[model samples]
Target: MALNEQLNKFQKQQVKCQSTLSDIASSRTSVGPSRSSVPAAISQRPVATAPVRFSNDTVRLTEINNIRKSPVGSQMKRVIQLLFETRQAFTPEQINEACYVDMRANKAVFDSMRNNSKAYFDGRRFSYKATHDVKDKMQLLSLIKKYPDGIAVSDLKDAYPNVLEDLQALKASKAIWLLYSQEDIAYPNDLKCDMKIEDDFKALFRNKDVPTDMLEVEKELLKIGLKPASNTAERRAAEQMLGVPSKSKQKKKKKQEISKRTKLTNAHLPELFQNLNPSGSQN
Candidate 1:
């Protein structure tokens, strides 16, 4: 087929698919058997795939421009391409390294992209909004539900790298949250097993009765940012707070009290001791 003919045919197919998708969406939302039944039949039909019209360079530049209108469009094009291709979350530093741009110097530009609705940033990671889909969003929500003790954001990134954007969207919409966020306490009961003492150790106390293990002792030390070995003084203080006693010290103190009582009783009975001594009686 001629190039122009192919383009026209592709455009027509694109329009048809758009109409079909709209019909499906509307039909699902509209109440009544007639509209609902139409969606089922339409859904069963094979849908036409959209043609790839844009070359790599065009697609990259177009996405960059859509995300930000500035001289850094070319630089940001590399950023956008990295995100779309990897489908993984990245920090600004990682993005800068991948895209070969100084994100530190262009912090304002990257920050703007982060704050924009087209991009998703959870303060530490970034992703393109287009990489996300509804199914992924739902799956992430289900995952959140599975771990009542909240799952780590890092774990989420590892499991659903491509859906980082969707996770952020869910967070923004209050569908999920970073576990134990004080500001948004809706997921307060979703316990997070973090190494940080305040979040993990104190959380144990908050969620359970008094801990009875040495691990709990370690957790209390961790919660207060103290090392058990190096911070012996602090560890002792924490142990005291948690009612963990030093068994050896207690035993030693008990022995010392018994010895002191014997010495005192002997001092009070000095006259009796003299009476029992033959040498004293002769003097």
Candidate 2:
């Protein structure tokens, strides 16, 4: 009986050892190495990822097909291309129709492109940068010519919000005229009398030419704020201003020549009379 019990005890001990070995193996597979066992360099290393980037030409091309294909990227390219090609200020609905993309769904795409592509394109609420400049140059001069009373700056801003830069450029070149309001005048001396008479003098000044006749020149001078005949006795002032020689000066020069001719004729008279009558007879 004792021998049989010892054999059973030994078998149970062997089973316990096998179970302990199995548990150790399972634990090792389930939990990996402890944190302390890991090397300091391996534990502290940062996770790496691929860099995100877009091509510079992505913003420049005016056709969707020109850009690499992607859902958001293709839509953005289409929107940009449409804006560039039409050269028109568009409403959100118009943009939707034109690009065939939903502004709501692609808000992120548009926003991203707008932020990224400002140097290449400036897209505003109702206007685009490139077209605004062209239109302003084409229309501003003609518009100024049409409205001699002066067009309101507010009206211009509303029509072309992006046009301030264009205006500044034209103004700097003196190609466009500015009309100051009474409120804008800091002092009475600051008021420009000539510009008041003509809202834009650049156009008028360009149209006028120096007339040949002093009288006609006088008439044109009157139209441009030069005082009429009686303002003062500044002789030939208009001619001098026009860079022309005065008619009076010309007349005086001609008279001097005629007087010289008369004096020469008188001097020769005695010789001719002597030749006709050698007896010095009076005829």
Screening candidate 1 with a backbone cut-off below 3 angstroms (N, C-alpha, C), the clashing residue pairs are: 149-191, 150-191, 197-223
lDDT of 2 by residue, 78-172 (tens): 66666656556666556655654555445676566556432133344434444223355557656555555555555555335456676666666
Cα lDDT tens digits, model 1, 134-185, are 3476776876776665665654554445566877687787666654453322
**TM-score of candidate 2 relative to the true fold:** 0.22
TM-scores, each model vs. reference:
0.24, 0.22
Lowest summed lDDT across 10 adjacent residues in model 2 is found at 183-192
- Report RMSD (Å) for each prediction in the order shown: 24.9, 24.6
Distance from true location, Cα of 194 in model 2, Å:
29
Q: Residue 116 of candidate 2: its Cα lDDT?
A: 46
